[model samples]
Target: AHGVARPAAPLSTFLVGFAAARNGGTAADIEQACATATGLALEWAKTHPTETR
Candidate 1:
C-alpha cells in the first residue's frame, strides 16, 4: 500500500457509469448511477466502521 493511491471515487461508481453509457443511457442516467453508488458506499461505511491508522 505504500505506493498505491486510492481513487477519488470507488471503482464501482466508474463501472456503473461505464455500463450505463455503453447501454445507451443518457448523461443524467450515468450521473444517477454514480450518485447511487456513492450513497451505497456511505451506507456500507455506516454499517462497518473503519479503524484509524
Candidate 2:
C-alpha cells in the first residue's frame, strides 16, 4: 500500500486471513491467499497508478 491505499493495508490483511480460514486454515491456504491478494494489488496499482487514499 506504499503508493496505494495505506489505510487499507490492515483491512487487506484481515481479508486475506479470513479467506485463508474459509479455504481451510493451513500454511498452504495462507500462502495462496497472500499470493492472490498480492497479485490483485499489483495489478490494481499498475492499472490505477494515480489512485490515492
Candidate 3:
C-alpha cells in the first residue's frame, strides 16, 4: 500500500473488518491482528520496501 491511491486505505480497512467479522471481531483479536500486521509490515519495509504495492 506504500504507493497506492488513497482509496486503498478504506479498502484495506474494509478487508480487515470483513476478516474480523468472519472471526470474533473482538477488541483483543483486532489488537492482535493489527500488532501482527504492523510487525510484518515493518519487517517487509526494512527488507523489501521498493517491492511494496
For residues 1-53, what per-residue lDDT tens digits would candidate 2 score against the true structure? 68666799889999999999999989999999999999998898788777444
Task: Give the winner by lDDT: 2 or 3.
Answer: 2
By lDDT rank, best first, the candidates go: 2, 3, 1
- Candidate 3 has a TM-score of 0.57
Task: Arrange candidates by TM-score, descending.
Answer: 2, 1, 3
Model 1 segments beyond 4 Å from truth? Answer: 1-10
Regions of candidate 2 where Cα sits further than 4 Å from its true position: 51-53
Please estimate how well model 1 matches the true structure, expressed as its whole-model Cα lDDT. 0.67
TM-score of each model, in listed order: 0.59, 0.88, 0.57
**lDDT: worst 10-residue window of model 3:** 44-53
CA shift of 25, model 2, Å: 0.8
